[model samples]
Target chain A: MTDVLSGLEAGFAVALLPLNLALVMGGCFVGTLIGALPGIGPINGVAILLPIAYGLGLPPESALILLAGIYYGAEYGGRISSILLNVPGDAGAVMTTLDGNPMAKRGEAGRALSLSAVASFCGGTAAVILMTLFGPLLASFAVKFNPSNYVALMVFAFASLASLVGKNPIKTLLGAVIGLMLATIGIDANTGVARYDFGVPDLLAGIDFLVVVIGLFGMAELIHLVEQQVTGKFTILPIGKSFVSMADLMATKWTILRSSLIGFFIGVLPGTGASVASAVAYGTEKRLASDGDTFGTGNPKGLAAPEAANNAAAGGAMVPMLTLGIPGSGTTAILLGALLLFNVTPGPMMFQTRPEIAWGLIASMYIGNVALLVINLPLVGLFARMLTIPQRYLIPLIAVLAFIGVYSVVGNPFDLFMIIGLGIFGWVLRKLHFSLAPIILGFVLGGLFEDNLRRALSISGGDWSILVADANSLVLYTLALLVVAVPLVLSRRKRMALDTEA
Target chain B: MADRIFSGLLLLVSIGYGVMAFTVIKAPFQYDPLGPESWPRILSVVSALCCLGLLARPDTERLDLTGKTSTRLVVLLVLLAAYAALFEPLGFVIATLLFCAVLARILGATMGHAMIFGVATGILGFGVGAMILELNLPAGPLRALM
Candidate 1:
């Protein structure tokens, strides 16, 4: 307890720095704007700003604080479009639209916005508290893991992603495999042999993660927006009152608490993200609540459940990234890439080596969440108005930012074309109903996965049995198997039950 | 139809990768039991299997790649490619101006509005990138004038 308190105190010392505090507020503001813009999600927002953040030369902790602020802020801001425009700002906000848009239609837009903000605060704060207590304990356990154990852990990560990420496991798995293959397109550091470089000098350094992110999320998102312009129309609701009654708060108090708990735990699970968290929480509430039929009819509890869960999940996803060096969500993968850029390897050792960076980020999230609640409640009108911004203006800015982000970071004209190519590929993949997150996770984990696998084999002198010899690895492998098997079993039983009913 | 074609392409790529993994990837000396080739070989086999699964059970979905959409997309892509080609020689501000203006015009903005937005975004973006970020975005011919 003392250790946590002291560490938190130390973290506050860093997070409370004038510059860091400014960054948190600034990031939250920008994040909210991005989140309010439909078709631009947190991933695109972060990917676009990442290079600029790095170029600004902020300290690692400060940059993390800013980025973390953007992350949680986007979670908060995603509700804006869902409520007023009936369009989700991000995938995590999809559930919010069910009840939120109905509420807006009923002229409760203000009440819904304020209530969801409060719910977000409760969820985000609650998740941070849980993360503070659980993160260190998990790291302490993970620190004991050996090379073989880590290889098993990586397997567990991949298995969870393939089974949990998208509608089709095969598509998800293929996406991951493609990502891993892309990660191999450079010189092999260990053997000093190039594989698939095609004799290009620019290929020697491997494909930059920034290029991939901007290409897939930023540039591709612009292309998606262009399509949206053809298919969809924008009509935003007038925000009504901007205030919630005390009775409304009392009605949703328990829903917020329960969804926060649900969201936090799901977030801690590998491969799942806010989309899953919000869906599960909303579904659970709908099933458990007596007024379940009122769920899609603008029920305040329905709105609160997903709003709380997604914010809580955002905080929850940080635990694994901080402790085990594995990203719990797509956004965290970008964060992991950012840490690597700053030469800060996040793992169990991060606590001992750079407590400030780790704890400071946690501390800043608390403040950022609060800052978002305050900023969102008052300026939501401004943000909601942003929904009126035309595609012509918005699309151009995204294109320009993508170009600047790539050129500033990689400084190669070839990467400029590379992003455009990747953007097209990403658009085609999205059209095929293939989730892109698995590819990112696979890419980010590819090096670590191969490194640990080879090390384990080397230590065992080519005997693969060492992977199964240790209890930790055995446990991890079993967990991996269970993660894949349980879903298949449950679905099969569901089918059988339906057949019997038929 | 798109899924089938994409999967077939993926299969071909995987086969090519597997062949290269075996034939091209060689270590001067063995540093570990599992060499660089082993990982790629594993990935290629898995990828090939997954691609086969996708091909066998291709998603029965249709894409709306209408003539208009395709024309706009191709023009946008060409404009983007040209932006890259011109980024070094034309400089950030001018290149971004032309790109954004043409893009805006394509997306249904008036020519005047597109030009105005292009100038505002280009000059403003360059200002922030150069002055605030301290990044060395190429100034090109403008450098001699400055």
Candidate 2:
């Protein structure tokens, strides 16, 4: 109890610093704008910012403060276009607009936007408090772990992520293994021998993370854009009311609490992400509504539930990130990497070594959430007006920001090339049925897997038995096996059923 | 080959890696014998087997490739490679401007409009990165101002 209070106190003190607050505000504002735009999402946005952060030399805590705002605020910002434009920014915001846009079309846009704001705050605030309470307990347990178990833990992480997505499991594994292989490129850290650099002088330093991120997300996305010759023009938004009335709030109080609980729990689970949380929340609300038939048709309660759930989930997803160092989504994965750059190793030790960062970040989130609600309500009119801007001018400026941000941080010409390369690749991946989540899961966990495997082996004199001998390690390993085989079992049963049908 | 694409990619990569893993003679140990490469390899092999299983009974969920999308992808890749090659020689502001402008045009922006954006982006980018972020951009001919 004392520990929790002290951490909270420390978080507040550290977060109050002027530099950190500026970063939090800047990140939130920028993140909201990007999220409001069509075709750009959080992963690409974060990847684009990576080089800038590296080049700027911002303190890790401040950097994280900014990135966290970008993440959570983007989760909040998607509600803008989703409510008015009838276009979902990402897969997650698809639900918010079902009724949100209809209400907008009916001139109840202000009411819908206001409900979204309050619901987002309720969900965001509740989850942040829950994270503050539970995250430390998880971290404390993680701190006691032996290095041998980290290998098993990494395996468990990969297996759980691999099981959830709906693609050919084999191909996903291939991409993940390739990521692991890429991570091992350059000189072998243990033996001091180069493994895969192919001996180029520059290659000796290993493949750069900036290079990989830009290539995967930036260049990939560009490719898709060029192929389609994409053109999206924004319409000017008329000023609308932005406050939810007292009567509406009183009517929806119970619905908000129920969905917030549902959203937070699901959000904490790895691989669930915001899309699922919103979908489940909508379904639950629809089932639980008294006059449920009006959903998808301009009802205020319709817009509120999914909006609340997704925001709530955004806050809840931080649990795995802060406590276990296992990120739940692409945005959180980027946040995890940013933390690593700060030398803030997550898990149990994070709370012990950098309670200021752990709690300060949590405290900043509390402040950041309030800032979003206050900032977004009045500003929504101005932002919605941005929809009227001409595309030629806006896209070029966005592109310029990306190039400048990338080049400055990496200080390598190659980094810009990588960004363009990956942007195009990302574009193609989006066009195809492939999910970027699996690839990221593969890439992030790849390093942890290899490092632990080598570390575990060196301890046990090359005998593999140590993996099974450790009790905790064994349980995690069993979980990994079950995760892999369960899908196979279900698929086989489905195949047999199909055969009978034939 | 289609079935083997996933399985074969894995099997082939694994063989190459397994052979390569031996180059370290003694194969240094960590706290255990697995070291850094062990678990990655174990996963590689297991996932490879899963691919093999899928290949043996290939399901017909074929992905259709559009010519324009594939062509766009190739163009994007080539353009980036070119940008990397020209970076040091062209310098920061010039290279980034040209790259951004060229990319915007290729991604479907009109040339005049694209160039205007490209130039604005290049200047503002250098300003923000250099002045505000305090990140050092390549100086080259711009060094006199510096």
Candidate 3:
């Protein structure tokens, strides 16, 4: 307990620096604008600005605070479009549109907005508190993990992803394998031989993770948007008196608490994200509500449930990334990539070696949440106006940003071609209903996975059974098996149940 | 179906990749028993297995790209390719201007609006790269001015 407190104190000392504070505010403001605009999301926002962050040569902690601020700020801003325009800014905010739009139509846009901000504040704050208490404990436990245990843990993460990300595990597994294969390019670390360079000089240096991320999420998203011919006028509902009474806050306090816990737990699980958390929270609240029939209409609880859950889940997703070195969601995976770019390896040793990065990020979350609430509530009207930006401007701007961002990274024109190639590849995969998240996670974790597997085998003289010899390895393997198996069984049962109903 | 064709292609690629993995020359001073080729071999085998599974139970969903949409994508891709090819030779300002204008036009902006936006993006992007971030973007014809 004392250690956590002291760590937090040191963290605040780092995060409260004038430059870092300015970055946090700037990032939140930019993130909110990005999230408010239709078709631009947290992923694009982060990927576009990542190069700027790198070029600035800011300290690692300050950069992380900036990026993390963008993350949660996007979550808070996503609800604006959903409530006002009935257009979800991202996948996670899709549920918000169900009741949020209806509430706005009834001239309660301000009430819904205020309720969402308060609930998001509650969820984000609670999750950070939980993280402050649990992050160190988790890291301490993970510190004892050996190479074999790490291999099993990676397997668990992959299996969970395969079972959880998309409806089809086959596609997800294929994406993951492709990613792992991509990771094997360039020079081999153990033996000084190039594995998959194919004689190109640039290939000798291997693919940059940032290039792939910008291509896959940023450029690919723009291409996908273009394919849909996204040209139309958006109608934003006016914000009436922007204030929620104390009675309104008191009414949904229990719901906020319950959804925050639910979202945090779900977010902590690998492969699950705010979409799942918000969905489950909304369903759970609906079932528990006395006015269950009023769910899709305009209930305050309906609005609060998903808003609270998604914001909490954003905080929850960071726990796994910071402690276990495994990203819990797609956005967190990108954050992990950023950390790697900063030459900071996230894992058990991070707490002892880089406590400032971990705890400072935690401390910044608290301040960011309060900052978001304060900035968003009064400037809600200003932020909502961003949705009026036309797709003609937005789409071209995204493309240029992707180009500039990728070009600035390696200062090579070849990376530009690579971005275009990967952008098309990502678009094709999206069209086929294949999820891109697992592929990215797989790429990020692939090097670590291979290293651990090789190290464990080397220690055991290539004995495969050594993976199951230790108790921790044994438990991890068991859990991995269960993660892979239980999902298949449950999905089969669900299909059978639907068949019977039919 | 698209899924079957994709899976079949993947199976072939995995097999080919496995063959390539075997062809990797062994290092003279190898320390570990499992050499550099081991992991790739393992990955290719796993990929081959996954591809086989996909082939056996291919996803029923088919990609539905209309002619117009597909044409737009191809045009956009060609424009992007041209932009990249010309990026270094033509420089950041001119190349970005051309790329942004063409993209904006393709996305339904009027020619005048597209050119204006393109010029703005070019100048701003150049300022950001050269001035703010201190990056060394190619200057091409604008080299002397810069």
Candidate 4:
């Protein structure tokens, strides 16, 4: 307990510096604007600003503070569009639209918005407290993990991702395989031989993960927006009042608390992000509600459940990345990339070697959550107005931003061509209903997975049985199999039940 | 179905990749028992198996692109390629200005509006890149003025 308190004290000393405070404020403001926009989400927001953050030459803690601020702030901002325009700002906000827009139509926009802010704060604070108490314990446990255990852990992450990411497990697995193949490009680390570089000089350096991320999330999204050309504009509703009544708060306090707990645990699992958490939380709340039939209508509990859950999930997703060196979501994957750029490896040793970056990020999240609530309750009107920006302007601006971001990183034109190629490929994959998150997660994990596998084999003198020789490895392998098997079984049971009903 | 054809092609590619992986030359002095080729070969095999599974259960979902949409997509792609080629020669400002203007027009903007927006974005992009971030963007023909 004393160690955690001292670590937090050191963290506060770093995060409370004037420069860090400014960065936190700037990140939250920019994140809110980006999140409030219709198509520009947290992923795009982070990718577009990543190079800029590097250019600023801020310290690692400050940079992460900024990026982390953008992450949670976007969660707060995504609800604006969902409540006001009935258009979800991002995938995680899709559930919010079920009851949020109806509440707005009934002239309770302010009530819905305020309740969401309060619920978000409650969820974020609860998750942060959990993180403070448990994050160190998890890291200490993971510190004892060896190469064989890491290999099994990576396999478990992959299995969980492939089985749970999308509706089609085969497609998700294919995407992951493609990602792994991409990771094998360029020179092999163990041997000095190039694997798949077709004699091109640029291929010798390998594909930049940032280049792939910008292409898939930023450029592909632009092309999709142009393809849809959705011109249906929404009228802005008036903000009648900006605070939820006492009765309103009392009614949904239990619902918010329940969903926050559910969301945080799910978020700690790799590959399960805010969208899944929010979906499951909202469904659970509906099932447990006294008036379950009022869920899809304008129930205040309906709006609060998803809003609270997603924010809590965003906080919970940090645990795996901070402790296990594996990203829990796409947004966290980019943050992990940022950590690598700062020469900080995120894993068990992070707390021992660099307590400032670990605990500072945790401390700043607490400050940032309060900052978001304080900022969101008042300026939400201004943020919501950002949705009125025309698509013609937004699309071109996003294209240029993506181009500039990718170009500035390597200062090579080949990366530009690579991004465009990846962009087209991503679009095609999206059209086929394949999720992009698994591909990215696979890419990020590919090098680590191979390294651990090879290290384990080398240590065991080429004995493949080392993978399952130990108790930890055996348990992890069993868990991996169960992760894949249970989902298939559950889905099959559901299908059979539907058939029987028919 | 389209998915079946795609999966079949993928299976062939995976097989080709696996075949090529076996051809990697070994170093004069090996560090470990398993060389660099093992992992790639393993991945290729996994990919081939996945492709075979996909081919067996190909999805029937298809995306139908209208002629106009397809043309617009092709034009945008070609323009992007052209912009990349011209980035160094024409400079960041001129090339980006042209790319943004054309892209805006393609997405349904008036000529006047597109040009105005494109020029503003180009100047602002250059300003942020070169002035604020201190990045050495190509000044192209506008080098002397700055």
Candidate 5:
């Protein structure tokens, strides 16, 4: 407890630096704007801004603070579009639209917006408090993991992702394999041999993670925005007075608390994100809340549950990323990649070696959540107005940013074309209903996966059984097996039940 | 249809990658029993099997990219390619101006609006990149003026 407090003190010392504070506020503002934009999510926002963060040459902690601010701020901002436009700004906000749009239709858009903001604040702040307590404990535990244990952990991560993230496990697994393949490009670090360089000079170093991120998320998102423009799905509903009554907050207080806890726990699980958290929280609330019947028709509890849950989940997702070096969600995966880019590997040792980065990020998140609540409540009117920004302008801005972002960071002209190729490939994959998260998680984890496996094998003198020889690894393997098998069995049983009912 | 084709292509890629891992990749000395080729080999095999799974369970998802949307995507691709190709030579300002203007025009902005937005973004973006961020974006022919 003293350690956490002292660490937080040191963290505040760093986080309260003028520059860091500005970055947190700036990132939250930008994040909210990005989140408020239709058809963009936290992943896209982070990916788009990552290069700029890199190009700015900010110190690692400040950069992370900025990015982290954007992350949860998007959680706050996603509700804006959900409430006003009836279009989810991000995946996590989908549940928000159910009651949010209904509230908008009923001319209580203001009440919905303000209520969601308060719920998000409650969720985000509660999750941060939980993270502050649990993060160090988790890291201390994870510090004991051996190489083989890490391999099993990686497997568990992959299995969880494949089973939990998307509809088809095959596609998720395949996407991961593809990501691993991408990681295998360029010279082998262990041996001085090039594996899949294709005789290209640029391929010698492998594809940069920034390039992949910008291409897959940023550029592809631009293409998707263009598609949305073509489809003509853009519309905005008029918002009335923007304030939440005290009664509404009191009525939904329990719902917010329950959803926040649910969201945080779900967020802590590797491979799950805000989307799952909000969905689960919404589902649980519908069963437990008093006005369950009005869930889809503008119940304040319905809006509060998802909003609170998603923000808490966003905070929850950070615990694993900062502790185990395993990201809990797609956005966290990108953040992990960012940490790697800064040459600061996130793991158990991070607290000891780079406590400033760890605790400073935590402190900044604390400030950022408050900043988001303070900024979002009143400025929501302005953020909701962002939906009116024509895609023609927004599209070019994003496209230009992608191009400039890549060129500036890498300074390699070749990466420009590479991003385009990757963008097209990513767009195709998205069209095929494959989740992009696993690919990134796989890519980020690929190096660690190969390194640990090789080290374990070396230690065992080529004996493969050493991978499961230890209790930790065995437990991890069992968990991995359970993660993979349970979902398949349950889905099959559901199908069977459906067949019988039919 | 798209799923099958993509998976088939993926299968080919895996096979090709595996063959290269076996035939082309070589280590001069081995400190460990498993060499560099082993991990790639394992990855390729897993990838091949996954590709097979995808091929077997070809999803019925369809992409409706016909009409003006498809044309815009293609044109945007070309513009992006041009932007990249001209980035270093034409400089960030010139390349961005042209690309942004054309892309804005394609996306339905008036010609005047496109040009104004393009020029503003180019100059402002250059200022932000070179002056603010201190990025090494090529100045090209605009070097003398700056």
Candidate 6:
């Protein structure tokens, strides 16, 4: 109870600032607009906004608050497009359309849209409240993480993230290695020397997070979509179809709460991110629903679970990053980069020295989430109109925006080339049934892992015993071994079976 | 194109990364506690093994890039390369629209769609880039004028 009151109090105090409030409102609105746009997502949107946020002279907390608003706002907004059009604006919304678009097609678009909007509100709100209450407690624990403990923590995150998808461990590791390589492209932070710049001046600064993300999410997707225009059979719903009903809301309430909690827990795990949370939540809900008959065919619970989980996951994912300085996803890593750029390391020190920054961000999550719910629910009708735009025109707009968004950041077209290159690569990776989330997690966490490894070694004077010298390290290492070994053993059995058949 | 070539390329990349990792300055350890070079080097070796694994095992999901589709992606990639290289020289608006229009055309958009896309995208991109995102888009010839 004290923790709850303190969290609420801290949140209210930090969030009550007029500038912070305005930033939250503006960020959410932009996030919704970006989400409403076909093909762009919160990651791309936040990434695109990074340069502007830095340029605007906003403090770190304000910028973080704004980014959070946009992040959650995008998650909520994505369902609108997914339901109205058969297209998912981002991967997180992919499951949403399994049920969301069908209801839209059945002239229940408004009901589907509103149900999602409200369910998202409940999930997002519930998670943010939990985040507000527990984030500080977690931060206190995180503050005490020694260098060795952090190294162990990161290792656990990497292994767990790799294991999230049941099949394709090799592919996961390959993608992860590639991501880590990308993470290492710039200068070596410790040595202040360039590692893999390959004499390119642009690479000396390292591949900008925005560059990789925009290219990874935006321009590349454009290329792949064009290449695979095998889908001329998509349907569109007329604007203003009433998909929402009080009944739909009631049916999804339990699913929303359950998914929200699940998403929050998943979010807290390093590298788990929203996609895993949503997929797991959807999978769980499918198994749990007695009316499994209704799911994936316009069931409100189907849309509600994943939508809620993904949004709640977005809120929940922030816990580890702010507390431990270890980002859960690529987007948060980019946010971490931004925080570092602002001279604020997001570890326990942040809580001690900058309570406003820490508490304020927590507080803004509450305000931002509520603001998003209110904004997206009423404006669902308008955002749904986005689906009516002819694909002929739509693809071009996305392509152009993608190119421009990539180009404006760092003002180099080589980055643009890399985006297209990575896009093509991403498209191929997607087709292989390999998930991209692990690769991103590996990329974002790679340097943190390396930096900590180096630090621990330096402290121990290159001794091999320091990692095992502590209880925390022992626990983390044990977890990592269990994750790596058990999965390998289990999956090897399946692989052998497949091999025998082959 | 993806089967044999991608594997070979990945193998080369892994070897190259391994060589780079081996050259990194780290104290050599006899046993367990891995150094900075350990993970990267291990990744390089493992990645190379994975590449070989791909070679030994055929890709069941064969990537079918037709000559036309191959030409489309390859040309699109090259055009992107050139587009990025000339962005500031041609002005962001012109370069971006041309890039989008060409991409749309190659992707099977009709001329009407391409033109509408080019114009609307240029205008909208300029608005968002300059006004909203606040990122500087080089106006090329308009550079001095602006």
Candidate whose DockQ is highest: 1
lDDT of 6 by residue, A91-151 (tens): 7888888998888887888788878888888888888788777777777777778777888
Q: Where in model 1 is the C-alpha error above 4 Å?
A: A231-233
Per-residue alpha-carbon lDDT of candidate 4 for residues A1-502, written as tens digits (9 for 90 to 100): 9888998999888889999988888888888888888766677788777766766778898999999898888888888888888878667889988988889888999999999989988888888888888899999999999999999898888888887778778888888888888888888887778878889999887788778888888878877778877656667777677469999889999999998998798788888788888899899999999987998889999999998899898889898999999988878888887888787889989888999899999988889889999999988889978888878788878777777777766778888888888889888888878888888887777888888998999999999998888998888889889989997899899999999999
- Candidate 6: Cα lDDT at A64: 84
The lDDT-based order of candidates, best leading, equals 5, 1, 3, 4, 6, 2
Error of 1 at B68 (Å): 1.0
Alpha carbon lDDT of residue A379, candidate 6? 75
- Report the candidate with higher DockQ, 3 versus 5: 5
Clashes of each: 0, 44, 0, 0, 0, 10
1 against 5, candidate with superior lDDT: 5
In model 2, what lDDT does residue A459 have?
Answer: 73
Task: Compose the digit string of candidate 1's lDDT tens values, residues A1-502.
Answer: 8888988898889889999999999999999998988877788898888887877888999998998888888888899989988889778999999999999998889999999999999999999999989988898899999899999988888888888788899998999888899999898878888889998989998999889888887888888878767435677888977588899999889899999999999888877789989999999999988899999999999999999999999999999999999999888888888998898989988887899999999889878888888888888899988788988889888988888888887789999999999999999898898888888878888888888889999999999999898899999999999999999999999999999999
Clashing pairs in 5: none
lDDT of 5 at B50: 94
Q: For model 2, how does the per-residue alpha-carbon lDDT over A216-318 read when each residue is reduced to its tens digit?
A: 7655554444443446554423436545799989878887888788788867766556777888889898888987899988777778888889888888878
TM-score of chain B of each: 0.96, 0.76, 0.94, 0.92, 0.95, 0.74
lDDT of 6: 0.75
lDDT of 3 by residue, B1-146 (tens): 88888888989989988998888546667767578888889999999999999888887568888898889988988988998899889888999899989888878889999999899999998997778878667888899885
lDDT of 3 by residue, A144-234 (tens): 9989899988888888788777778888888988888888888877777887787998988679987888888887888888887656667
Name the regions of candidate 2 deviating beyond 4 angstroms. A166-168, A232-239, A386-399, A419-431, A458-465, A468-471, A474-502, B1-15, B22-32, B35-37, B53-79, B103-112
Candidate 6: the clashing residue pairs are A108-A243, A109-A243, A110-A241, A110-A243, A110-A244, A111-A242, A111-A243, A111-A244, A112-A243, A220-A423
Candidate 3 chain A, which ten residues in sequence have the lowest lDDT sum? A227-236
What is the lDDT, from 0 to 100, of the residue A245 in candidate 4? 91
Off by over 4 Å in 4: A235-238, A499-502
Best by TM-score: 1
Model 3 spans with C-alpha error above 4 angstroms: A491-502
By TM-score: ranked, best first: 1, 5, 4, 3, 2, 6
DockQ, each predicted model: 0.78, 0.45, 0.69, 0.65, 0.77, 0.37
